[model samples]
Target: MLLTIEDLTKTFPGTVALDGVCFDLRAGEVHALLGENGAGKSTLVKCLTGVHARDSGTIWLEGKEISPASTLEAQEAGIGTVYQEVNLLPNLTVAENLTFGRQPTRFGMVSGRKMRAEAEAMLAGYGLDHVNVTRELGTYSVAVQQIVAIARAVALSGKVLILDEPTASLDARETETLFQVVRGLRERGLGIVFISHFLDQVFEISDRLTVLRNGRHITTADTAGMDRLELIHHMLGHELEEAEGRRRHRQGGVERLQVRGLARRGKIEPFDLTVREGEVIGLAGLLGSGRTETADVLFGRTPPDRGDATDADGPIDLRTPRTAIAAGFGYAPEDRKTDGVIADLSVRENIALALQARRGWTKPIPRAEQRRLANDYIRRLDIRTPGAEKAVGDLSGGNQQKVVLARWLAMNPRFLILDEPTRGIDVGAHAEILKLIGELTAQGMSILLISSEFDELIAASDRVIVVRDRRHVSELVGEEIETGRIIDAIAAHENGEGAMTP
Candidate 1:
């Protein structure tokens, strides 16, 4: 084994972030660390990299007991980490950023020529010669930046490389390129720890899998013997009997919201979809399959090239989020930390933010009234915070998500677009969120739900729309919306074949 972690434990103020987690990584293996948000996956990674010292654990690197007290120590000991956010300096050229601390110098002077040459050579090894090493790193797209980060980490000569959601912002072609690089790394005998929400990518690349739930080690097994549903069940901590029971109630009603010829150039293709008034509609596809893109168009994040939405009220022109809001549309974006919540603001301020924005900043809602509204939501949604005065950032991941939902719930929208609403939350929180969606739909609200979890999409949505290659390729309703069918449709489209529709 390249690395072994035994009985690792970590605790924060009110939470046990990691509890006796054990795992092993082998050379020439891609091990996927799977879990929902706040499930100790992050803690495990931090512990491995020395970002957070573990409370108790035994870490053996190449059969030698080592406790790295800092990230630099971990790096020197041949352990590297590439986080979700790009850590390279934006102002510096790619070459300089890659060799930031350990620059090749001669006679106490940095060798720019050597740096550029080495950087270019390293990038070329990963099929990234198209990106100029001398150019500013920020000028390139996120995919290119990610590649640079990975290249830098590998160039550190690390025996184990930890990639945390490296492909979250990457497109289809970019993800393919990354997979190739990962395969190459595995071939070179590097133990890679892949962390991602995209299960298909996890299955495609990972040789072994370790699942964490609520800061506890759940299971570790070979990827080849495990199925998608089983992996999800492990991550969710759902009993087989409970899942079977839920599966029986999957089928629901007719179309509530209908979209025809929905198109957005360079975003999504002309698509058709429908969701019943009392039903949840799921958009399932790969990273750039236009799932979130379609949600953007529907919820007025972006203007569609040419498309129309028909609801009980009538056909509506959703040109912008303001117009969509006025037409009774609500949107909860994917990244709650960035797009959904205001970290600096109090819970009251954050919860009333959307309503206040819709009302226009000039005509502000009275502070007293805003407090009242916030308090009501806090009570209704069971938002866990000290008080309405607490900063939104101070709350737990699940609680912060609740505040985001409360913001939209205050709008009383007819149609709600939830883009990865349950992402980065625990199983209990996910269940609560899903239950809330079901409750809203039962009360005559139409919803467009998008999730990376196939089972979550299938379980919560009454109908499913599969997008592939930035286009809506298939629609499955009622009995047709099964995991196997959805996976088949997505795989078919991904491999250059059109999705089979029903």
Candidate 2:
């Protein structure tokens, strides 16, 4: 093994991010670190990269016990990390970004000519020789920027390279390009740690798999023999039997919202959808499969170029989020941190946000009413907080998610859009969110659910719509909504014969 972590542990004030987690990486191989959010993947990565100090653990790099107190120290000790968002300066030229800190110097001045040559040679080893080293990095595509980031990391740390969600923003062709580079790096005897939510990508590139759940190491095994369903069970820590029991059988009422030819160019293809009263319509797909895009269009975050939608109030033009809200629609975005919650505000303030917005700024929701709403939701959703005045940022990931849901629910919208609502939360919180979904649906609240977890969708959805390459390819209703069928639909090709190569 080129790198090994034994009994690694780290903790915060109220949470143990990692507990006795062990991992190893062999040279010339790709090791995939798999886990859901709050599964200790990030914590482990941070500890390894010297971002966080481990409470207690032993890290061996090439048979030498090492303790790196900073990222620079880790890099110097032969470890490098390239994040999803490239850390390189976008305004600088590619060569400058690569050789920013360690630029070649001559006669007490930076040597631009030598720096550019070094960058060119570095990129050439990764088959990125075509990229002009002198061009501004921001001008190029995200895939190229990623390659540049990888090149820099490799130059700094020759042994271990950690790629965190490297292909999240990349397209199909771009992903293939990045994979070719990664394969070459592996062939060169570099130990690459691959972290991503895309299972297809994992199975394609990984030599070994390590799963973590709730900050504990579950298992480490070869990727070749591992079944997809089995891997999911490890990450989620539950059997298919329990997930099956979550399958709901609610009878939908009259059509609440009907959409026809809704689309945004380059985002999602024109699609038709119908969400009825008291129904949970699930959008299932791989990451970047237009699941979030569909939600955005439905919520009027990105208004459709050409589409017709009608509700009980007749034809409704969803030009913006405000219009959507007026139409009795509420959306809980996939990323709660940036888009959903105002972490700086109190729990009470956060819960009352949507209602206050709908009521207009001039007409404030009275303090008493705000208190009542917050108290009601805190008790109803079981949000673990000392008081409504507490800052939402101080809460756990699961509680923060509940606060976002509470904010939207206070508006009592007829339609709700939940995108990855149970993600990153603990098992207990995950079940609570699912139960809440069922209860909300029972009360005639139409929901458009988007989840990467197929079992969750299978359990909660009355109907499942499969999205592929930003297009709605198939829809499964009634008994058709099962794990096998959903996976088949996702892996199936355009002609419906076999799996998609990507």
User: After best superposition, candidate 2 residue 362: deviation in angstroms?
Assistant: 7.0
Query: Model 2 RMSD to the real structure?
Result: 6.0
Per-residue lDDT tens digits of candidate 2, residues 368-437? Answer: 9999999999987768676899888866555787899889889888999988887545444566678878
Cα displacement (Å) at residue 165, model 2? 4.4
- Return the clash pairs for model 1, or none: 255-276, 256-275, 256-276, 256-277
What would the per-residue lDDT of candidate 1 be over residues 70-129, giving only the tens digit for each residue? 888898888989876788888899988888776434413767788788778777778887
What's the TM-score of every candidate structure? 0.72, 0.71
Tell me the lDDT of model 2 at 426: 43
Give the least accurate 10-residue stretch of model 2, judged by summed lDDT.
493-502
